[model samples]
Target: MNIVFPTLRNGLFGAILALSPMLAAQAKTPADQLIVGMSMVNLFSIDPANAPGLDASGINANLYDTLVKRDNGNPERHVPQLAESWTVSEDGKQITFKLRSDVKFHSGNPLTAEDVAWSLYRVMKLNFGLATTWKAYGYNLDNIQASIRATDAHTLVIDLPQPTDPLLVIDSLAISPSAVVVDRKQALQHEKNGDLGAAWLVTNEAGSGPFTLSKWSANDSLVMTRFDGYWAGPAKMKRVLVRHMTESQSLRLMLERGDLDLAYGMAAPDIKAIERSDALQVQALQRGTMYYVAMSMKQPEFAKQQVREAVRNLIDYQGIDQQVMPHYGTLNQQPMQLGLAARLPDPGYTMDVAKAKALLAEAGYPNGFNTTIRILSEPPFIDIAARMQATLAEGGIKATIVTGTGNQVYGAMRARNFEMIVARGAERYPHPYFSLRTFVYNPDNSDAAGLPNFQGWRASFFNQQLNELIDRAGVERDADQRLKLYHQAQTLYDKQVGPIMMISQMTDTAVSAADVKGFTGDDAEATRYLGVYKQR
Candidate 1:
C-alpha cells in the first residue's frame, strides 16, 4: 500500500527530487506516532476470551491490563500490574490479590476486583478456545464463580479447584490472553444473550490500558489512541497505527523508506539485506511456540511405534535448521522451549534412511506407504514441508504436500482429520510443566472428547504414564521433584515415539527504524507499547 505524508522542508525535497523514484517516495513518520506493518490475516478478533492468535495477543496487550505481567528478563517471575500485591495461603489452594484503587477503564469506570473476577468468569462462561487454559486447570463454568470472586472492591480471591501449583496459575494470569481484566459494568451494558459483550468486544475494548482502541477493521487497519487518563501514564507515542500488510517485499520497501516504523513477519532474505543498513534495526525475538510435524495416531500406519520411529528418523533436522529455519526459528528437538532449566539436551535424532527403512519393514511397510502432509501456504512451514517430503521419500515414504490457509491447515489437525501436519503451536510461554502438558499430556484420547486444545489429543497420542508425570509435575511443591517429573515425562515420550516430533522453536523477527526504542517483545507474544517511543 502507498503511504503519503506531508511534504518535508522545501529544500530537503528539492535536494532528493532528481534521485530515483524510490528515493523520491521516502516518507518520514510523525514524531508522536508509530506506523507498523504486519500480516493481519489471523487477527480477526481482539476479544481476549476467544482470540488465540499471536497477532491478536500483541494488539490486546496494548488495549488491556492483566492482574500481573511476566518479567521480560525472567519468564518465571511476575511483576504486578492491576494487582499491586498478592499472597498465597499455606495450603496452596488460595490466592488473594490486592488491586490498585486508582485505576479506571477507558469508559471512566473504576477498575475494581469485581471487574477482574468478571473477566475470568466471562472466559469460562464463553467456553471459547482460550477457555481451555482455565479448563486444563480444573476450573469449570459451574464452579468458577465461587472459586474466583471479589472479596471487596479492591480485593480478589481465587480458590484452586484442584492441587495444581499456585505459581502456574499466577503465570497463567501473567500470560494468558483471557486473563486481561475488562470493564464489567460497561461490558454488561452491551451484553446480549448472556455473552458478556463478547460480540462488542470483538472489535471494541473496554480496558484501562495505556492505549485505547480508536478504530479497527478486519483485514485492513487498526488505530490505537493514547488514553490521557491512563493509570500507568500515557504511552510515549500518541497514536499507534497498524496497517494490514501480507507482502514481505512491501514491508521491506516501506521500512527502508522510513514510512513504516516497524514490521513483523518479514522474510529472512529481506531482513539479511537490511541488516547492515544504519537507518534500520532488526531484533530476533524468541517466542515460546514450537514448530513440529505431527502424525495422527488414528491412522493405522502412524499407530505403530515402529512406524513413528521411522518417520522421526526420516526427518532432516540438521539440514532443515541450516537451510530453511534461519530467522524463523532455532534448532529445538525437545517439546519444551530452549533456555528453560528443566529442558534436557536434544536427543540428536538425524536422518538415518537405513534405520527408517528397517523400521518401516518391521512395521509391515516394506515399501513406504503413501501419505498426505498438511501445511500452511506460508514461509518456513511450506519450506520445511518440502524438505520433509524429500527426506521422507528417501526412506521410501511417498508423501503428497497439501497447502492451505492457517485455518484450513490447523483446523484439520484440531479436528483429528489430518494424517500429518507441519505447524507451530499451543504453549506461548516458557515453562516446563505447561510445555509438557501442551505437547505430551492427553487426559482423554477419544474423538468424542473434542479436546482440540491439547495437541496430544489432536494427534490421538495418549500414554497414561506421560499424563500422570505431567500432572504430578504441575502440582509438585518441591522444585527438584517437579524437575524430576518433567524429565521422566520427556523420557517416556521419547520411548513411546510420540506422534508430534518437535523440529524448532519459533523466533519472530521484528524489523524497525533505528529510532523506534523500547520495543521489547514478550515471549508470550503479549508485547506492550507503553514504553516504546521514537528517539526522534
Candidate 2:
C-alpha cells in the first residue's frame, strides 16, 4: 500500500515533509552498514525450491550455496563454489564433482556429497521453480534420482538421462532454485507430514551463504545479518536492511537524504538527475530480458497474421525509446540480444499509423477493435502501457489498460485468460535456445502438459516447424550447424509474427553514495555483496 502525502503547498504538510528526514535519520543504518531502498511489495517466498520471484531469488542467492557460481560481470563463466573441481565422462553422459571438504553449513554440519544428491533430487520431487528447466533436459521422476547420485562422501556424480549437451544442464543448475543447496538434516527436523519441510522453509532459510534472514516483514522491510562462519569469510557489513519503497520519488528522497546507502528502481529522469550529483554514482546494467506486448491468438481479431504484423508495426519503437525510455532501454525486436552470436539485424520496421490502419482494413476490421492491455501496476511499465494505448487508439484500435500486481497480471497471462498483455521476459543466459524455448516452441500445448516450458501456449501459438527447429538445435553437436538452425528458428519466428517484442531495457539503475565500494552493477548478480564495504 502507498501512503500519499499531502501537497507541499499546504503549510502543515510542508512542515511535516521537512521534518521527515530528521526523523528517518534516527532509524537509518550506520555508515558502515548498508541500507537499500528497494522497489518490491513483499517477498513471495524465501525457500529456493519454491520462490520464483526475482527479488526472492536474489535474497536466496545470498542465503544459499550453489555448486557452481558466476562472477559479478559474466554469467557464462562458471567458477567453483561448493565444488572445487569436477570431471566429465568421455561419453558426455556422466559428470563427477569433487566437493570441497572444508565447507560446513551454517548449522556446523559438514558439507557432503549426500547433501548434493539430496538437494537436486528434492527439486525434481517437489516440481517447482526450476523443475521445468530440468524437465527440458529430460530429467523426470522415472530417471531423476536414478541419474543423480553420490558415489562417495565427496564425489557427486550426475548421469544424464539422455546425451545432448552437458553444458546446458550445468548452466541450468548454475541458476537459482536448481543450484540452491539446503541443510537437509535441519530441514527434515522441521518437516510436517510429507512436505520435506517445504512448508517450514517458506519463512526460514537453511544454507551456508554470507548472510541469514534476520527478519522479514511483509510489505515493509527485510533485514539480513552476516554469518561469521561463511566459507568465503565474513561479509563486510554487519547487516543489510532492505526497505520497501514503491514510488521512485520516495527512493530518490531517501537516497538524497543519506538515509539509504543505495536505491534501486529509480525512474530514468531521476537517474539522469542523480548522475549529475557529485556525491552519488549512477550505473546501468544490461540484462538478457525484454519487455513486450502480445496479442492472444485465442481472440478472433488477432488470429490473422496480418493483424499481428500490423500490431508490431503500430509500436512507436523509436518514439517511445527516445522519449520516455531514454537511458533505460535499447530498441530490439528479435529474441536474440545484441552481444550474442547468430543474432539477426533488426528488420527496420518503424511506426506508420496509416500502414497500421491499412493492414487492419485488409484483415476485415476497418475501424480496428477493442482489447485490454494487461500490465503490472509499477513505474515505467504502467507509463509505457499508457503510451502504447494512446498510440494504438490513433491507429483505430481501442485498448483498455488494466494494472495489477505481478501475480495478478502474469497469472492472467499464464492462464491464457487475457486478450493482450505487457510483460517482461528474461533468458536463462544470452543463448538463442533459452529464448526460443521459452517464447516460441510448445511441444505440448494441451492443458495436461501444464504448458510448463512454453509461455507461447498462453498466446495459443503452436508451430510444428519451430518445434522441430528447437529440438534439432538442442541436440545438434556441430557448432556451425547449431548456429544455422538457431538462425533459421529466428527467421521463422519473424515470419510467423508471433509477438510484438520491443526494447530490451537496461534492467535497473543503481544510485548509491560515493563512499560505497564494490557495488556490482549487474542485476543478474544482485545478491553478490561479499566485496561491498564503506570507505572511511
Candidate 3:
C-alpha cells in the first residue's frame, strides 16, 4: 500500500480541498476542544484491567489517574499523582502510600486508600491478561486482599508475596494500565453476576482524571469532557474529540484542511510531505515495543540452535530499517530497549546468506527447509516479512508469508502453533527488568502452564540460566549487581540463539497543528491531555 502525497509546491492545498468536503466545511477546530484522528480498530476495551492495547491506554490516561507516574525522561524516577507520599520498608518487602484527601472520583465519591487497594484486588480477581503483571510479583486472587490492603482511609499498604526488588513493584504501579485507582462503590453498584463491573467498564469508565467519558461508540468516535472537579486542575480544553479514521489519506487531508488538531498512524509519505509545513509539527515518540522475528521452538526444524541462528542471519535488518521502518521503528537488535543503564550494545548481527547456508547445512538441511512466516497484514510488519522472505530465499530457506489480523497472528504465537512470526510487542515501558522478563524469562515451558503473557513462553524458548539471571536481576537491589545480571542475561540469550530475534524498536509518529502546545507523548502510551491547549 504505497501512497504518494503531492509536494507542497505541487497543489498540496488544492488536493486537500478536493478530497474532504466534510472536513473543509469545518476548517478550524473548536478553540476549547482538541480534535484528534486515529485508527481505533484496537480500542475495543477501556476497562483498565483488560484493556491492553495502546489506544485504550491513551484513552484511559485521560480518563483515570494512577497513584504515581514515571518521569518521562527518567524511567528510574517516579512522581506522585494521587499518592501524596510513599515509603518502602528497609527490608524492601512492604510499601505504604499516603493518599491525597481532597481527591474525588468522577462519580462524586471521595478517592481513598480503600479505593486504591480495592482496584488492585479487582485486577487480581478478574485475572485478565493485565493481571499477569501483578501475578509475576506474586500477587494472586486468593492473596491480593491480604497482601494489599488499606489500614485507614488515607493509608494503603502493600506487602510483597516473594523476594524481589520493591522498586520493580513501584515501577509497575507507575506504568501498569491496571494500576489506576477505581471507585469501588461505583463499580460494585453496576456489578452483574459478580463480575465487579467488568462488563460495564468495557465501554464505560470509573475514573478521576482530568476528563470524563461523555460518550463512546466502538469504531466510531469518542468524546471526553473536562471534569471540573478534577483534583489536579481542569484541563485547558473543555472537550477532547477522537474520531476513528483508518485511512491515512483521510487523516492527512483532514489535518491539512485544519479539521484535525492532531493525527496519528498516517502513512509515511503523508507525514514526510507535511513535515516542512508551517501549519504542522511532527513528533516521533519512541515506544518500548520491539519488532521481532520469532520462530517457535516446537517446530522441529527451528528447535535446533544452528537453524535458529541461521534464521537470525537470514533476516535483512539493515534493509528493513533503512527502507521499511522510516517512521515505524529504529534499528534495535537487543531484547532490551535503548537508553537504559542495564542495556548492552547491539551484538551487530547482519544478513549473511553464506553463513546462514552453512548453518542450515550443519543443522542437516543442506537443501533448505520450508516454513511459514505468520504476520499481521499491515504496514511495516508485512513489509518486514516480505523483506525476510526475499533474504531467506537467498539462504536456501523456502518460506511463505501468511498474513492475518492481530488476533490470528498473535493468537497463534501465544498458542505456540506457528512456525515463525514478525510482530511487535509484550513490553510497553522502558524498564530493564520488564523488558528482559517479557522477552527472555519463561519459568515453565509446559503447554499446560498457559503463560502467554511472556513472549518467551509463546515462542517456547526457555533457558534455565537466562531465566535465573533475569529473576536475580529483578530482585537484586544493588544497582551495579543488577546491571551486571542484565548484561549476563543478554549475552546468554545470544549464545543460546534465542528464538525471538529483535529487529527494531517501535516509534509512533504524531502529527499535530503547530498551535497545539503541551502535547508530549507518553513513553508508555498513557498520554494524558490535562495540560494540552491551543496557543490561540
Q: Per-residue lDDT for 253-318 in model 2, tens only?
A: 777777778887778877877888987898776766677787788789998987887888788888
Q: In the order shown, what is each candidate's alpha-carbon RMSD? A: 6.2, 3.9, 4.3
The residue-level lDDT of candidate 3 at 341 comes to 81
Regions of model 3 farther than 4 Å from truth? 1-24
Query: Could you give candidate 3's per-residue lDDT for residues 438-492 as a string of tens digits?
Result: 8888889999877787889999989898988998888887889988999999999
Which residue pairs overlap in candidate 1's backbone? none
Q: By TM-score, how accurate is candidate 3?
A: 0.92
Which residue window of length 10 is worst by lDDT in model 1?
1-10
**Cα lDDT tens digits for candidate 1, 407-468:** 66777887899999999886878888889888988888987877777899999999998898
Q: How close is candidate 1 to the true structure, as a TM-score?
A: 0.92
List candidate 1 segments past 4 Å from native.
Answer: 1-26
TM-score of every model versus the real structure? 0.92, 0.91, 0.92
The Cα local distance difference test for each model comes to 0.87, 0.75, 0.87
Pairs of residues clashing in candidate 3: none
Model 2 spans with C-alpha error above 4 angstroms? 1-23, 26-28, 71-76, 523-525
Q: How many backbone clashes does candidate 1 have?
A: 0
